[model samples]
Target chain A: MIFRIAWRNIWRNKIRSLVILLSVAIGLFAGIAVLALYKGMMNSRVRTVIYSETGHIQLHHKTFKNDYEARFVISNPEKLLQELRKNESVKQVATRTITQGMLATTTGSAGVQINGIDPAMENKVSGLLQKIRVGSGFEPGKKNQVLIGKKLADKMKLKPSSKLVLTFTDADGNIISAAFRVAAIYQSENTPMDERNVYVQQTELNPILNLGNGIHEIALILKQDTATHTVAKQLQQKYPDLLVEPWQNLSPETELMIDTVDITSYIIIGIILFALAFGIVNTMLMAILERTQEIGVMMALGMNRIRLFLLVFLETIFLTLIGTPIGLGIAWIVTSYYHRNGLNLESMGKEMMSNFGFSTLVYPEFPTEKLLGIMGIVLFTALASCIYPALKALRLRPIEALRK
Target chain B: MSTVIDAHNISKIYNKENIPVYAINNVHLHINQGEFTALVGPSGSGKTTLLNLIGGLDKPDEGKIEINGIDITAMSPNKLIDFRLRNIGFVFQSFNLIPVLTARENVEFIMQLQGINKTEREARIQTLFRQIGLEDKMDSRPSQLSGGQQQRVAVARALASKPQFVLADEPTANLDTASASNLLDIMALLNKEENITFIFSTHDARVIERARRVITLVDGRITSDTAKVDTHVQH
Candidate 1:
């Protein structure tokens, strides 16, 4: 009966109750939508880093990563490749002979990381061949053919079929210069990576470095990204001499970004929940004040303070329950629509996002776990907001309240 | 019948922070079971204060109030609330009904708080509603009824728990003459039919004339306590 009374009491002033309900619903919708946008942006950045720069896992000579010298090359590369091919978790593997060098044209020169990759295998791991913007990917038997970023080509005033000179130290510590023709110009979302990286056939650069059949790095993409750590740990235990790391370890900046995004999203949610709490408190207090005489009558009729408190508590919870699903449903529809078609911020933030290594088009993702977590947060917020008003109701003296 | 209420030298002081004004000044009073009593006085005469003290809604500043042989003043606040719920019923001048609840719900509310079962609560509320001539208005909210009808529902609510006594503070103050007379007739009939005790404070002459015992107060002191017999007993 008390519960029924409480339920009916909220509707006594329909406008007031609806105002509170709408505020809660809109607050939740805004918070959730913003969180989804940030989640999408951060997830996109991580995916780009893994698929373009660092594969799910990477292996290098223990000293190769510390200094990108051609001399520090992986040993017995054929044997390791064979072993990795038999592992079920390994989806694809590519080898690269890395050298920090300079690329020069008749007009200009710039510092670059030249990656000598096996075209076919590198395509499977990095999807490099697919991002070709200006020209076709490397021809199978072509010698001294290279892929350069569109940005680097533009900076050096070169294009497909342009001749460029790569200058670097060979394994014997001799200054060596090799000439290569650009087969393709790729454009990725990451501006800096595009400008600083150039790829050539490993067969071509390894011979110039006088490091026959040797490679500096082996990158692997797993069937599932989550298997990267397990595969990395296994590789480490088997080949203790090599450096084996997952994308998270190889790209600590992106890892930190993931953590930072999660923290900031929660902080945003906390702020929104706190703001909604104050609104709820104000509404509940108004309800209590308006029903002061009725509350006194109940108390005088032997309704205890605890029951009075429960009545208010139940009312607030009902309001939250009514509002939360509506908010979530609206957010779900909005996010789903964007997730399918993509939310394109190209006109507004394309350049900014690309500079930070994120794509301009984002697919907002509302994970089931996050949705459940937000529901829990709303309920807790409602319960917390009710405390002050419920206590205020309990503090009323029956005689004085009745007089009022 | 035993003494249902014993207010011994009870004094209630208001405005003790700046001015200590006595609302009920060491007034000792007693009433037996099944008595129809009226506490009447002019404004500021402490009739409501006396009723509040007796109902356990407020505690007296000095001296004790005992109801049905239990010293309610000595009980804890929680115990006093429980005691009031079982022992006394109250009707307010404004007919302070829970506006959201129907007339039947108002009558059922105290029994619900007492954890009464649904069947018994329905049965008791039905009987009381019938007794107050409000069986047809049981489903009506206080706002949907007239002032007199609301007051009758309030009376039925006060009697729903079958308490030892009912305390009404200016219950008919808002009613018209016909409604006030109709309400007093119901109360007098219930007093005769069920031997139920009723102690109400009123300035209405109609209610005062029907009360078997009239206690008038002036300036927080009972100026007169008179009993008249052989008149409206047949009503």
Candidate 2:
């Protein structure tokens, strides 16, 4: 009966109740939509980092990454690569002979990480071949063919089939220099990565450095990205002498960006809900004030304080509960539509997003896993917001209130 | 008849820390079961104050009030509220029916607080609505009902719990003469037929004329206590 009364009581002032309901609905929709956008942005960044830059897992010599010195090469590279290729979880593995050097054209020179890679294996591991924006990448039987980033190519005034000089140290402590024809100019979402990294055939570059088939890094993509941690841990245990790392460890910045997105989204939603809570408090307080005499009569008629509190509490809950579903439904519809069709950030500029390593077009990813937590937060806020109003109703003296 | 209300030298003072004004000044009174009593006085005469004290709606600053042999003044607020739920029913002058509820729901609300089951509550609701002559308006909300109809619903609500006594603080103050007379007739019928006690604080002559006992107050002190010999039900 109390529940019935409380439910009915909200409709007493139809416009006032509807206004609060709309406020809650709009607030929740804004909060959820922003969360979805952030989630989408984070997911896009993570996908790019995993598929375009780093594979799901990478194995390197213990000290190879520290300086990329010619001496610090992986032990038993062929046998490890063979074993990894046979593993069911490993989708593709590629070995790279990485060396920091300078790439120079007639116009300019830039510091770059020259990746010595097998055309087919590296293509399978990192999908680098699909990103080719210019000349056909690494034609059959081609030697000393290099793939330079579009940004780097543009900076040095070089194009496909242009000749570039690569200078680096040999394994035996000698200056080694080689001229490589640019095979293709690729464009990745990350402008800095695109500018700093270039690729060439391992067959041509390895022998010049006298590295003797020794590789500096072994990168592997998995069938499913979620299997990354388990596969990395297993590989680390199997090859304790080598250093195995997941993409998250290999790119801490991306991992940190994900965490920061989660925190930032929560903070954004929290601020919205915090503001809406004030509106709820104000509305409920006014409702209580308007019903002062009725509340007094209720108390006078022997309605217990707890029951009275519950009545007000239930009224607030019903208001929020009704509003939340409408908000969630609208959010789901909007986000689902956007998720499928994509929300283009063209107005924000493609170059700005590329610089930050994010695609200009994003599909909003609704955080379905966080729905329960979000609802709990909203319920807590509603409960907390109703406290003052409920307490005010409880504080009314029957005689004094009745006289009002 | 057994005494249902015993207020001994009870006094209620407002603004005691500032300029103290006694709302009810040390008034001792007793009301028995099956008695239709009226507290009559001018404005600021503490008639409603005394009714509130007896109903356990307010505490007396100076003295104790016992209702149904329990010292309500000494009880905790929660316990007093429960005691009031089981023992006393209230009817306000403005016909303070919960505006959101229909006439039947308004009456059922008090019974609900008393934990009366639905079967019994429904049965009593039908009886009370018929007794108050608002049977046809049972589903109507307070706002939809006329002044007379709403007041009848309030009266029905007061008796729904089958309390030891009904405390009405100017129950017909907002009603027209016809509504007031109709309401008084219902109360008199219920008093004579069901033997339900009624205590009213009012300035209306019709209530005073119908009440078997009238206690008049002036300046928060009782100036007259009169009882009629022939306590017959008046039309």
Candidate 3:
């Protein structure tokens, strides 16, 4: 009966109450959707970094992790590949034999980093497979095929099936040159990674750096994120001479950028939550004041102050219960729509990615844990709004309330 | 047969403008069971304040008030509220029925507070409305009814609780002469037939004339206390 009375009393000023409710709902919904979008964008960017550029785990000779320029190529790629393929968690194991080299064409010569991998193995685990914009896929186990970044390819004026010679100092300090055809071209999201490294099938890196069957690093892809750390740990024990780093270590800037976004989104949402709380408090106080006489009559008729407190509290709870889901529903609809079409920041290309320290084309992901936090915030704001009004009602003298 | 209300040296002070005004001052009074009494005074003569104090709607400072064998002035705020719900009913001069509620709902309010079921509460409300000559108007809201009809609804609400006493503050003040007479007659019949006490604070001549005992006050002091032989009920 008290609830019935409170509910009816709330509608007496329909426009005012509705205005407050709508404001809270709008604020809450925007906060919820933005938070979700932030998380989604982070996951998509992180995914591009991990699967396309950085594998789940990378293994380097103990000295090369601290210094990438060190020529500590793993002496037994054949043996290590066999050992890694034995682990069931390993989805694909690819090799990278790299050196700082210069590419010389008839027109000009420029500096670059060279990475060699088996094309068949690279595609199974690397995101580069999905990023091939033109030309054929990486040719398998061949000595003359290479994949050049789109910007690098544009700068060099090389197309698929075009030939370019790579020149660099060998381990013995002798300059060597090798010829290779551009088997594919890739548009990299991040510019630093794009302009420097050109990918080749394992033996194609041979004559340019005077490298042989050995690779400087081994990249392992795992089926899921949980397996990444476990596989790294296992590989570390298996080869004590090599240092294994997870994808997070391979790409710290991406994680840091995502963390920054999460905190910034939180700061914005916190302000919105504060505004929403004030709106609820203002409206509820007005409601309690308007029904002062009715409350007095209810008290005189033997309803306790606790019951009166609940009457007001329940009105807020009911309004929030109805309003929050509507807000969440709106958030869900927007998130689902964006999740479908995807946010394309592709226009600025590598410069945007390098400046932001992320891949430009970001896909949003919605995980359960973060999305459900919105309910706690909405409920807490609603509950918090009722306190001052309920306490004031409990303090009022019955006669004064009736008289007023 | 015995005193049902005892107010001893009851006083109420209002702190307005930091200047204390004594609304009710050291007043002593006793009301017996089945008494039909009227307390008459002009505005701010402490009549409504005294009535509120007796009705457990307000407390008296520096005094003792015993109602129905309970020293109610000593009771806690919550206990006093319960006492009012169980033992006292009120009819205000403004006929402060919830404007949204029908006449029957206004009368049935106290019974609903008592947790009475719909069927029994409805029947009692119907009987009371018929007694007040508002059977057909039971479904009408207070605004839909005339001022006289609205006061009858207030009178019916006061009696719905079936309390030992009804505290009415100028209940007939808003009504015309005929409605005032009619309300007083219905109240008189209830006082006689049910042995319920009716205590009213009013300046209405019609109300004072119908009272079996009149207590008149001036400037917070009683000027007269007299009893009439009998009220002439206009048939």
Task: Write one digit per residue (lDDT tens) for candidate 3, span A69-158.
Answer: 526778787878897888788888888877778776676767888777776777776767677889876655555777888878878888
Q: Write the per-residue lDDT of candidate 2 for residues A309-371, one digit (tens) a residue.
A: 999999999887888998898899999999999999979899899999999889997889879
lDDT of 1: 0.89
- DockQ-based CAPRI category assigned to the predicted complex of candidate 1: medium
Candidate 2 lDDT: 0.89
lDDT order, best first, reads: 2, 1, 3
Question: What lDDT score is found at residue A54 in candidate 3?
Answer: 81
Which ten contiguous residues of candidate 3 chain A have the minimum total lDDT?
Answer: A359-368
lDDT at residue A206 of model 1 (Cα atoms): 89
Per-candidate DockQ versus the true complex? 0.79, 0.80, 0.38
What Cα-based lDDT does every candidate model obtain?
0.89, 0.89, 0.78
Considering DockQ, which of the candidate structures 2 and 3 is the better prediction for this target? 2
Residue A135's lDDT within candidate 3 is: 86
Per-model clash counts, in order, read: 0, 0, 3
Task: Tell me the lDDT of model 2 at A127.
Answer: 83
